[model samples]
Target chain A: MRKSMRITMILLMFLLFLLFLLFLSGCGDKIDLEEAAVPLAAGIDLDENNKLRFYVSNPVFGDKSNDVQQYNIPVTSLRESRSLQDAYTSGALEGRNYQVYVVGRKLLQHEDWFKILDVIFRDARNTVLDRMVAFDGPVEEMFAVKPKEQPPLPAILRGMVDSKSKRGTTVLTTLQDMHRQIYEEGLTPVLSEVDYDSKQKSFRLLGTALLTHKGKYAASLGYQESVLLNLLKKKATKGVNLSFAIPGEPNADVFELDRASFGIRKIKTKIVSSYSDNRFRFRVQMKVSAALTEQLFKYDIQKHADILEAQLTQQMQDQLEKLIRKFQRNRIDPVGFGIYARAYQYQHFKPLEEEWGEVFSHAEVDFDVHVKIISMGTIR
Target chain B: MNQLEKHSLSFLQFVFIIAGIQISIAVLSTPREVSLIAGTDGWITIIIGWLITSIPSFVVFKIMQRSSEGTILDLLRKKLGRWIAILFTLIMAVYLGAMAYIGLLRTLLIIRVWLLQNTSPFVVLLLLFIPTYIVAREGPKLLGRYAEVIFYFLFWLPLVYLLPMKQGRWLNLIPIAKEGWGPILSAVPGVLFAYTGFSVAFFLYPHLTNKQYAGVGILLANTITMATNLLIAIVCFMYFSPNEMVEINQPVITVLKTIQFKFVERIEVIFISLYIGIYSLVWIPCLYYMAYCLNWVRNGSGERKYLIGLLILIGIGTYIFIPTFNQSDWLEHHLTNFGIVVEYILPIAIWICLVINERMRQEGQPG
Candidate 1:
């Protein structure tokens, strides 16, 4: 009787398993690649009416007529905008393939706007590693720039930031990094900037956009200052090239030869933090071990190498000081000097944590550069 | 079944059982809870938590050593009264049942979020019980072997976390003990819960082939658990800033999101799916031991019957009420409190009572 009971139990379980597979397969909900509106880029900007606009560009699979579809709607919330996207697309918007999240300067100039991104971090589906690009004008203009002889705009934007960042020309920021930076009191945030020239119908990758703790745009850094910021932050290490005009020389031709250029092979930066008289001080000394990549109108290299080094050191020190003065004037700490002060002098930094940017603008800051020309490249 | 030999479990299997059970759903969020209190110095609290937990673990090992041929229930029935023994059985059965439920529910919740968004949690809970019943019916011999096999299968999980270490900043970990020892010590009670499964040693004692090495086995188990928690805590701490760490629900898997291979994307999804394999390590043993506890309550009468009955109860319970994520978290919190009473406080109280009672009885006998 027990053996028969066990046999009956096994059969019952088997029947239940079959019943489950037949009824609850969940296979009917499967979405094919073509049926899904897989967005390549997601953009946020302030529309002409000063309303927050959400945009997504999805590529059409196996059809070139509507090669890519661009849709924009004035949004009140970020994630809710995904549900309203079915108005234009054949299928629902899929966020899994987003390669870039383009931020318009108009939206970034407002205060407390970073909180709109709460859905991005809260939802598990949104990609965090997508590169974050700051567009100078409306992000719609950026999406409108469909350059010929190129890949898609999203790929171009992503590759543009990646290539410039690798060359130490701009900073590489991601959605996750920005999320980290806002909460990280030790450092302010920065993002890679891009501008479009309608006359040329091309988008240009510029330098970094400095942001305050409230996610408001503070100031902008050009390529040279961006390289200095990268060196101070020690993020970009490979292919950092710097150019300088020889001191006291004006351009004598339409093509000027007064400037010299060199690629940075090895760079080192040291910062010392001290507190005195109710203020903090940082002595930032940068040591550059460089190889000359290009030199325009240099008479002799092997002879006056020390003179060149000394001259470059003086010029570079002036430039580095100028960058620190810019940071002070803008009341930003992208170099994260606050981290050093907090780490070494905790008691003093803890009290001023709320307004470190304001206090930093009034603190004592200094910079010095040391140049060592390790090689003159193959030409010399 | 009759062909099975005495002393069926090896010493290493004994250690893996404790290690596997101790590193359950709690290890995934240990860093987050610890970071909320202790900041980046949380890894140091893990060390101190080890020192605190290993003490009680050793005491439980001592209690188990007194009765090598039987479990804590047998020891209590002999030394303490039958009523007290029954009381321990009922309390512990409830605790272990709650743990098994939470482990099963959490696995389903993760699956519902990451892998199969549309599948019902009750059906998946039913599916998990198949293996739970299969291995559990054979007793601890198969459970120990099952844990050992799963251990070797998912052994590379910790190594997978190291891939994202390159993008992590080391500055996040510095300025240790920034708030002094108060917060670090307060985080210990939280880690004490992650260390709760070591109390399972009471039932695991009789199954060991070489019972003399049980003490060393448990010490090794606590060290293994501590080392695993330390590695995960430090990795999560370094990868996310403390402010970000506190906000994430499961920073452990979230850290693996940044790792992209040429063939795969969102590796965290694959890891979360594979994590269900580890869930068996938790529930299978808890199910069997819970049955063992109730069998003791019936004076060693009907174990398999109680096992089947308990599994059915859980099956019906989940069907009637499919738990959301927050509900499972509530269950986990209550389980930790009950586990503290059953696993931590009761053993020490039992050890004291057994010591005093033995002294009086030995003095009267003059042995």
Candidate 2:
């Protein structure tokens, strides 16, 4: 009886193990992605008739080679759909299943753009966030301008974003970040806009696209302006090029200012209020170590570093003032002045939200740039 | 008609089970709320709460050391009379059983929403309870030994979950003590709940090889739990704004899902599977405690059959009652609040009464 009981127990254990293995195998079969194609990048646009146009990419094996190739398929709808499901069904009829549908540039003008985003997020199949992008034109145009000899559109975009050599403005914003920005107070959503040339079959980043809270197309910041915005937000690299002309020089000399290496001794922002006219004045004091890129003057630049410091200080001050005025004109609060007001002086920001455009326009901003050339790139 | 064999658990096993109980389904949802109350200083609150809860744990451990051969139920009966002791034990047993059932249910709901959407909750619960009931039926020693082996896997999961910290904003932790002491004080009770399972050591004292080391073991376990909670809370705080955290249904799991791995697409699926080990760790002790309480109440004879029958009834009732996520949430909140009172306040009260009784016994004696 004891021997039989042991044998029965052994058989029972074996049966349980087999059942466990079968359960695992069943789970494995349910999770098959073989039929489903994973999309790398998605683009959306509105056609001439204001119909929803969806662009999707899927990689396929190249002929006579082990290398993979990407193909862009465009699908267009006859009428503007209120829901993504409608748009998706229309696209599906065109023989393309969009795993991710980007909100086209024209949709930025529509009031229900956030509703589109909600539809995308609600779907489980469209799980990838990094591949989603918002375009300035028809989404199909972006797909038409692939790199001449690149692995794929996704690889190209990923390389551009991850490139270490590209100083400043290299960080890529995912769809998740954009979603957060939309909900966050005092922050505007920024997306990379890809403009394509059909004749040349080439695509280039048309700088960052900015959106207003009501899904209005505010404006696109040019490449240089976007770089400046990134720097102000501290999202850009520390080692960015700063160009300024000498007092009598014919040519403008460019200096690579390594902000990381530059010893910033102090940064003080004083908010001074004048009893007269009820105006707030922002005075910024910045102290930094100077580094020279080029020596235009024959005189010992180090000896008369004080003169160089004065010139550089004035240039930096003027540049910063121009950028600040530009930001105010554009009604962009990338410097997070609004965030500061809300977090610190909540009462002040309560009314400022309604009158932000006018308030920001008249706000006094003073810059005090003090530069001391602590070192000259470890060379005399 | 067999009595439960006296079985002892190793220190490591005790730590694993206690840690599992401490890190519950609430940790997935409550970190953000706690952070909102305490701001960047929320980690400080976890530490403070751990210290406060440790005091009771220390007192219970001391009492258990004195009565080395008896469980907390025994000490309660000896010190505070049988009726009150039985009443308190009943309350604790119910609370623990509810908590275990609710935890299993909540986890099933998460799995359904995130992973196995097609699978029924009953099937999921059955799958969970089979392993849990088998191990729990083996008595506390085997449960503890199994916990010791599984604890290694649990410890390694957090390291993988926290890899996305590189992108976390350190600035989000700024403006420390911004809300001041008022909110911090209010959030202490919730933080105290995170350290609730340290009291489990009291019940498991008889099963400990060295009852004296139980205090040290509990303190060490509490410290580790406190640190883990603090880290997760801080990370959640840094990742999401106060408004966003509150809006999220399951903040911890959602945060884990946000972390995209190059090789592994969704880490939350892994988290859900590994969490079963934690659930079993918590449920076994709770079931054992329930059995222990029932045995004591029935005068310790023919209790094994009764214990198994009661477990099945409780499990089935809980499964039926908590049919949806909303209902489970309501049950969990009320039970956890009740748990704080029974687990912390009542234990301290029993300890005080026991101390007084010992003093009276000594004073009443002639020198």
Candidate 3:
């Protein structure tokens, strides 16, 4: 009896193993690589008739005709457009591999435009690590401009924005970061801006698109102002080169220009928050250590370093003050002064937290900058 | 029926058995749950929660110390009455079964959502029961070994959660106590529920090779649990902004979604799949205790029949009437409350009765 029971137990184990192999190897939801349509980039734009247009650029595999297969359709929902897009594409649309989400300026003009991208953050399978970019023109025209010598538009655009962002010429805004910016009262959203020029047949990397707290397009910052913004935000710790025109340049040629460039080795920014009178007051202190990279006009540096440093400090202060005034004019706090205020002064800032942008517009801010030339470039 | 069941668990096994059970489904969502009540000060609630649980934990140890050779049922039958012992056994048997049942269903729901979406949950439960039958049939001895193996095996998993904090904002933790102590204290009771499984020490103390170190063992288990909870909570707070902490659901796992590498991506999926080992640590032992309670009522042998019957019943019952995710959440809500009554309230109540009974016996003997 014992031998028979032992034999039966082994047979039962085999049966269970067979059952596992049968049911556990799922055929119901498995999608092979060829069957999945992985979108490299997705664009959201509002058409002239106020209809939402969704665009996805999917990489085509094993097809010699073209490397990328583009699809666009007018739809009310992003997920719903996948079914609509199936009319032209062979594979199932998957958002798992999305590398970028491009939002047009036209859609960004609306106050509630950010609510549409909720699906990306809500879904468990979808990724939110992709860059969030803003287009200055209609997104449809961008799809039309395909350079013959370059890779697909999505790859080119991702590479360009990534490199530029590294060089501190543009902002790199991920979907996760954008989500925080939209909901966080302390700061506003800033997307890396791009504009396609039809005559030049090229895409231009415009610095950064500034949005109000409600995600509406407030203003645009050029490359230089974006660098200044980067300095204040302390994002560019390295590779920050500033070109300033010095007064001591001698006219050597008909097209002689007085210019000096320096690479920043280190920068320290401090914001002091104090509330007095009718408006909140802020004292901005910055110390910049730089290495002189190029100089067109000759001057003795060792003896009069203080005067040169003072002059550079004055120029940087005026530029920073102008940027702060511009932010105040637009009622935007891209420098995250409100973040510091909430962190350092929570009790006083609680009542005004809802409309901090308006409160900040009337606030007083003074900039104090000091520049020190730490080193000069070595000549071979 | 069982001769060699004595001296089954060493000191290390005893400590790990309690710690493994404490890190159940609660660890995954504790950050979001506590932040909902305490805001950015959620981590402070964990310290207070540990202190509160430490009281009930001591009471449980005292009750177990009164009868080190047997379960609380044996002590009740000897000191009180058969009626009281039967009642306690029935209540605990049902409570333990329900906890194990709900824990299994919750694990299945998590697996279906995160790991296997298309596979049948029935199949998943059946497959889960195979290993459960293997470990639970022999009772606490095997359960102790399972705990030790799992605790050491997955020791590095929690360390993986620490990597993402390199980008976390330490300033989010600054200007602490923004909302005052009221909300932080309110979140304490909720965190106390996560520390509930230490109550399993009632059954485990008898199997211990050294009853003298039982107190030290329980304290070590609680410390291990506290350290794990504090680590995950602090990481979630430091990595996510205060606003983002409240917005994201299951920030523990969802935070890992952003972690990327050149070789492998979507590390959370792999993390969840491997987390199945830790999830099994909760239910397998509880199922054994449920069967043990039934054997205690019968006053019979530690036969394998009881465990086999309970396992088959659960495997088939769940297949016939599948539990949905929402139902599992509802079950979890009631289970935590029921666990507090059993793990927290019952020990203190029983200890009072034992004290009164012992005092009456002394008076009858001397006077």
Summing lDDT over every window of 10 consecutive residues in candidate 2 chain B, give the lowest-scoring window: B1-10
lDDT of 1 by residue, B260-365 (tens): 7758767788888778887777888888889988887777775778889988898888778877878777877777778778777888898999899999998999
Predicted candidate 1 versus true structure: per-residue lDDT over A1-380, tens digit per residue: 99869966995886688567647665444788767888889899998889999888887777463477788888899877877887778876677658899999999989788899888777775568889989998888877665676678788899999989988788998888888788777788999999997787788887999998788998888898898889988886856888887876566669787787888888888888999998898988888888888877754778988888888888888887888788788888888888788877778888898888888888888877789998898886
Q: Which stretches of candidate 3 lie over 4 Å from their true place?
A: A1-25, A63-66, A247-256, B1-7
Cα lDDT over the full model 3: 0.82
Candidate 1 lDDT? 0.82
Ranking by DockQ: 3, 1, 2
Tell me each candidate's TM-score.
0.94, 0.80, 0.93
lDDT of 2 at B339: 70
Better of 2 and 3 by DockQ: 3
Predicted candidate 2 versus true structure: per-residue lDDT over A1-380, tens digit per residue:
99769956975785687567557533541523444344455555666777656555655424733233233333343123223323432222221223234557776777546545554444332343464445667665566654656556766655554442145442255655655556545455566655565666655566666666454567776655665456555565445454565565444347433222232222333332221255445555655554555454443555777877787777767877887787677665545554444454445544666555456557677777777766555444
TM-score of 2: 0.80
Docking class of 3: medium
Task: Report residue A248 deviation for candidate 1 (angstroms).
Answer: 4.3
DockQ of all predictions against the true structure, Cα-based: 0.47, 0.22, 0.50
The residue ranges of model 1 lying beyond 4 angstroms of the native Cα positions read A1-29, A63-66, A248-252, B1-7, B300-302
Order the candidates by TM-score, highest first.
Answer: 1, 3, 2
Q: lDDT values of the candidates?
A: 0.82, 0.62, 0.82
Judging by TM-score, tell me the better candidate of 2 and 3.
3
